[model samples]
Target: MSKIQPLNPERIAQMAAGEVIDSLGAALRELLENALDAQATRIQVEIWPSRWQVRVADNGQGIPASELEQVARRHTTSKLDGCSLGFRGEALHSLARLGSLTIQTRHADDAHGWLATYDRQGELAHQQPAATALGTVVTVADLFADWPLRRCSLPQTRPLLTLVQNAALAHPWVSWQVRQEGQLLLSLWPGQSLQDLLLQVLPQVDLSDLRYQRIQEGDSDWEVVLGLPDRLHRPRPDWIRVAVNGRFVQMPEWQRLIQSVFQHTLPRHRYPLVVVHLRLPPEQVDWNRHPAKSELYLQDPEIRQEQLRQHLHALLQSGSEQASRRSLHLIRASEAKSVYRVTSSPKSPDPAPSGQPSTPLPPLKALAQLYRTYILAEHPQGLWLVEQHLAHERVRYEYIQRHWQPVELQMPVMLEGLSSQAVEQLEQLGLEPEPFGPNTYLMRRLPLALWSEDPEEVQGSLRELSRCADLEAAQVAVACRGALRNGIPLTLEQMQQLLEAWQRTANPHTCPHGRPVYLALAEKDLARYFRRRWGICDRPISDPKLGSWWELEPLGDRFAAQVRRSSSASAPDPKDETRSAPL
Candidate 1:
């Protein structure tokens, strides 16, 4: 048998390219991450589509002339001591194998920088002097030039271009640019807030009702901003972004939690848009779970997912409740009868009408509140009995339930003395709070009334809410009670207005507390009750029907003929399931 010599560097490089990095974009992302980890203040990326060249220049710390060879070698990194999430061994090797890799660097202490180029032999092809700077610049040319199979498998330019745009949107705080044939296709400015970036990129998006959120779980914290009802757009499933420890991840559970909250509230096709920032202790998460670093593994993932969901639900509930309360207040204030004094305007009224004294009249009739609940009013349409408490509660509940953008609070509110049981339970309910004080906590902002106003009340409510395993139901209950108990009286005009408002609300039949508001007696049902129509007229009644006196007749005997005919007409088939079940 002939002895086999080791494969040549060209063969090794080709094999490495195919085996290591999955795609050109993923390979580029790895390099970018390294630059970011190096504390680069600004990074500039240039792409030459015609020449198949990609270059990334960063003002980060550079490799010295002496260390140039080692830096270009495979499986080498200065940033990791094996404790970091993305300290993998194959990034540099894979890039070097697939393309012509060149690196130019300047050390802070030296005036001159070193430049090195690596060829297919796994050795430095050339090393020379370079320009003066205290940073590193890497350029890759002829990507996948040696590997026809890998190059052929790569996606076309359009999807690749979209990828670049998405990356820029994900990191608005970092300045970035993507150029094709030396022409800029994507450019992002630094210091831009996420919302600003969203508005700038998604011009059609309405962000007027955006709000902020934060949730703390021991050392872990979550922050986010969500869009309001009018701001929310349909069909875009990925309107939400979740980041752990300032690094973004594409966690499926995050979407599920928020989607579950809005599933019943939003229409069948509508999706809630949100941007969430999660910060957990570095040790608690493994960010290298995927090549893109968009997927992560939390040590206690179930707890984390639940925490995120509850926090979002809380923010949503709070915001809706607050809006409902405000609207109710406005309606109450508007209902207060205003008294006008007759002065110079009275001179005009005196000529218009004859009065014993020129006195302005009060309301035509005083509206009565029956049983401290119903409002009896005479409208132009007809007499209306408005269930005051239930109507107001329904109005408040729907307004609170309306979708809105998320708002972040300047200060985090942390609740204290929470039983360990409650804390554990809260996580299951998705209420993760960040530490703010000795024992108090700051919550990720949710809609105002979705969460309890008092922290002490929240602990119990959360526990109960979780027990039923139905948070939305619990939220409705709480909101309804608060709304109905306000005891805001309504005038006749306001009562009429309440009907208009209720018509605009969702599920107007039930109060926020899950109680019925009104019962409309239809003409048919009312007539049936009086044995006038659609009634069981066969029953013997002393009252006469249609001016005819009721004759004495055996009720059962008279109904026998009708019952026999009905039974015969609707007789069940012998082969039916009910008949076939048993003898």
Candidate 2:
């Protein structure tokens, strides 16, 4: 007996519908593509309160009465030219199987519109004379109701709204309106600019601070509009939009290009807002990679990515400089494809100019301490408020990473008669022990951080040493133990030394555990908190205690000079004089 069998036609249709209409977004995308292919100048979408009913209407060339019923069948499409948005006639067939689908359409010369409904078998179940304008309107209600698994697994509202937004962004020339549960979510008139669309996309940014850059290379065009370079986002920014040939797409290659461009400019914890739109010939892209068409295939994507990177890099560099037009290349008739590059004007990028005291730590003027925990200080680039303990921890961790030493155990003497394997492992880890009596081995030394560990912890760590995966695990453990603890009081002189030490570490932003060491506020930020006489900011205060805020101010350096003169007692830093920092 043969086990293989053909699936029932209705079952096949239902399964195919699941593939094409997996989510509400995918269903809307197919309808949207059809509307765009129709050259619709106006489109409207409506969703019911339960999100089970959706209607998409478009004003464009509609189906003729004779072929209206055939549109429900699979592979029945008029776009044999390969230039249209959607060609495989699976969407309507899928919709028919997924739910009850109704389409109302009429041509311009027709007397009136006709309504047709499709059954689950990809057949026209009903048809009748209807009233409507010269266009098409498709309404699909109770979507995926027959396929309960698909309905239960998929989201309706968010996907539908996101799909509509992308469609609106791609077809900026089309007037569009979207409503959910009888309330309007988005309404846009035709002829709105890309910048106008982006304003709604990134509502947090000021409109004026957004910068736009355009590049035209032969038949392809690229536009990258973004916020100011200093605008920092903590998470991967969802506002970044990418459109290729008038269709918004999510491509990893393009995403990589955008992200890599800002890698050097921004810290690891931050991202920038970039809206990129590229227009190429229709033949250069294929949108059939995924069921929803979110993935895109580009012609020579690497070349496009490199070209886009150079253009964006030049834009950022130029913004850093005044809008001087010094970096952008003007291609002449003979050299039209010359690549553009941005180079520093003085060759060596701006000199760390004099007049500012030359030091790793920018000279800072101390302000009043905040709540006896944070130290407030002013520098040229910004006003800095530093957490007292974390700042010292950052400095000490860097020092420990550079300077290693052996620790004497404070616990019981090393175990006697340990297995040779344990002894070998401990020796391999640099914790050498020697036998003083019969099978009595004593711990000579261990990593300083582990010296004070309970005997059980030491034994456990040694037992697990071979299983430790990370090479930095040992370094991090030692550094964490060696770092300064919180609640330790610091005089003004000790605080200054700690701040200077903090500035010298390679990565002063974060400690070994990746927590921030300090919070930096700009001069304008300080002004926002404290009202001051703007004109007198540069002048020395008449009160002996308050010095000029803008100038390099001192924090008890004079008092420290006096203390050094009077007594031989050194500053408060633990092991400060013993170990010099790495050069």
Candidate 3:
């Protein structure tokens, strides 16, 4: 006897059916795709978790009565043009082999509908005449019946819900409803725009913060909708959705690319909510690579990747620039409300004198320092509360990045407790450290921003930088260390200078570590809080006499001087030394 023998047709069919209809989710996907291919504008899905059954009904161009018998036969499909989502007629056949299959369909030309049933081997069992609408309805019961383990392992609700959501995202124009045991689980009506769909799906994000853009280059066109830089984000990348040729897919490389575009603006380990749709010529797309059709291969992938990167960068940069211009105007308007006299020199370069045109800064007028941590400033539209430390950090980070050359110290600073890995990373970041004593390193050169930092603090920052895996992260660590400490009081002139430096940085909205630099309370909001209409005060009050209720007392000049000296001599409170977490 021959050692090898060809498998019988029955066994071969069974294996192929197992591959196509492996789980409840896969079976539902195939049925849903078939409905879409039939040009369905409305689809309804019903699931019975207790019995492992699924039913899908659609208002589409249904199967003709003449071809109804052959619908369950393998390789028998009317869509030979390869334009439909399901071109191979194996879906119904595989479905029949896995469980009981029934299809009732009526074409537009037919006066009546026909109902057909098929057995496990896909053999036609019964046929009857039925009155029905102009569409198709398919039901599959006892899915994976023969494979007890697979049937028991299948999820009942979440998988089905996710599948429906993915389909709905790609086809917002199609009305859909998914029910479980006759209880409605999910529903989407027709006539919804793409932005509306996104907002409905992701309720956590604000609609105004979302941005939409469309780009067409060469043989491909793309539609992108995403949150503004760091405005909305999630802990993981699960919220990023991508669709190719109207089919939602799992494209890991594409998701990573999108994340990389916003890496600088978003905090570490955070991802923005984004939706991307790419439309390419059918010839350039290969959907046959996966049985589930969840992955695709595109021609000229390198060219497409490069184009996407450039366009996304431009879009985000443009949005940032517009926001900056608006902020500048608002700041100038606010500055017009008050006037101040400069008393002390600014640590950074001074802004241009009153009338000369220079780099635009949101000329906010500093009113007072609040709690020794926040700077209260006046803006035309509202009140701005700036986190003094983070504002300075943003300024220092940008400054260090722009001027990164190292300067040799007259006397080398010795750092201890640095690991070998940390020492190597420090050197790569332009801080040349040489081994001195046991577990100690001598830093001969430092970045200009860190040249004046105290030796002990520099050592601490260098130790922190040594643990960073990348040069950019190390630089951020260094910048955070050199920034002004919290709880340190600032003079009026110093606060003004700090705000100018902050507004001049490339990204003033967030610190290098991605913390917001300031919070704005618009005047209009304040009016609402007081139950007054904008630009109109509902209640009028006469000016009160202060001396009638309270008498003014002045402190002795010697006592005031002593209090100032004590404050200047005090060290930073340990409770206020909160630092930004590492990237």
Candidate 4:
């Protein structure tokens, strides 16, 4: 017998079915594509999880009654020209092999509809006249019943719902609904604009900062809608959706291109929510790259990529500059508010009477500013060097934490261009913006930190804060932006005030951004570096007796003598004066 032989018909059928209709999601996708290709205006999907069955009905030009028997036959289709989503002609045939397949349809030319059933071999087994509207209904029962393993591995309802939603997004003009066991899972009406459809699908995303653009080239038209870089970002790139020629497909090169445009704008390991649709002439794209028709090859990919990159860069660049200006205006407003605030003068510390306990951090006297960045101070236990910027950040962060109360505004501010979901999120974060009009809110109060901010800037900041992953991250961003910058001169009184404020913070060791606020050099470490005989040096270095312990012989003279001795000797010692303990 030959080692390799042709497979039997039953085994071949099993393998082919496994490839095309592998999961419930795959089967649903095929049905949806068929409905869309038929120019469906309304589609409904019903599922029975207990029986692993699905039914898809569509209002479109359906199959002809006379050709109903040939619908499920292998290698039979009307979309051989590659313009339609399903050109392989194997979807119905493979589905029939996996389970019981029944299709009921009525063509415009036919007087009535016909229902046909197919067996596991994909051959028509029964045909009968049926009363139905001018459309098609495909039902698959007991899917993968013959293959128990595959049946158990089928996907759950979520993937099926996702498939339907993707189809709806790609064809927003069509109405769609999905139900499971008589319970509605999703419903989308027709005549929804693209922006409205996106907002409906992605309720969690804040579309207040959304940007849209359309471009037309020689034979291709592109529509790009996306969220600008803000506090909103996802840990994964799954939010990026792309559709080509009315078909939702995976184009990784384009996804990466979009990411590259926002690489510098967004933080590391974060991605923006972007939706792109490209409509090109059929001849410019090859849709036969993948078996399921999820991937495609586009002509002149490099040129298209460059064009998209330029467009995104231009838009985002202008957006970033505007954001910066808003931030600057807010900061200046805050500074103005601080100037008029009443603050008590710093009082000198009184000596502890009868030896009472002191605070957690010992009172330090500010000596000088080192390099105009770090503050040098004298502490009881050691010499302290504090990063000016980090210390100020911690101070501001804690102040905001303790004083983050909402104050009633004298005049109610009208915040426009906010989504309903955005308003809800703002309320959850303690803004309590009431709905005033369509995509507008009436804000009667504002957070204490944002009180002095302009109404427009406050609106922008609130939108950013609402979209952030959490409260702490938003606080960090605000504190970081408003903190004192490094390399700026500070007076002795200003330095002292900053140090006093920092000392009162609950977490003074590290800044809100997790950077070390100060470095402490203890007396013992300093003594050890000077090669002192005893661990502690209580006397001053100017004292003649303590001079030997404070000063060390020049290292260059010792190194030179060692090198001369080594040259005169037969061999140098492995370890010499060159190796010394770290200072």
RMSD of each: 24.8, 24.3, 25.2, 20.1
Cα error, candidate 1, residue 42 (Å): 1.5
Residue-level lDDT tens digits of model 1 in 484-531: 443566665665565556544544444544444543333333343333
Better of 1 and 4 by lDDT: 4
Q: Residue 148: error of model 1 in Å? A: 1.4
Off by over 4 Å in 4: 1-3, 8-10, 317-583
Give the residue spans of candidate 1 off by over 4 A.
1-16, 81-85, 153-172, 192-203, 287-294, 318-583
Judged by TM-score relative to the true structure, which candidate is superior, 1 or 2?
A: 2
Say which candidate scores most in TM-score: 3
Per-residue lDDT of model 4, residues 12-94, tens digit only? 76777788888887888999999999989999999997888999999999999888878898879988776788887789999
State the lDDT of candidate 3 residue by residue for 1-583, as single tens digits: 7788899999998888888778888889999988888889999999997888999999999988888778899888877775667877788999998888999989998999989999876778899999999999999998878878786564669878888887777777889899999999887876455666777666665655677777887778887778786466789887788888778898888888998888868756688878888889888889888878889898988888787787777767654423432344455554444232222321223223442223333457788999999999876777888999989987777667666678888888888888878788887776878889898989888766566647777667667777887767766777787788999999988998887767666556557766657776668655544436535433333336644211332544445577889998996775654222211
Better model by lDDT, 2 or 4?
Answer: 4
Judged by lDDT relative to the true structure, which candidate is superior, 1 or 2?
2
Q: What is the lDDT of every predicted structure here?
A: 0.59, 0.68, 0.77, 0.76
Q: What is the lDDT of residue 99 in candidate 1?
A: 82
Scored by Cα lDDT, where does model 1 land? 0.59
* TM-score, structure 1 vs. true: 0.51
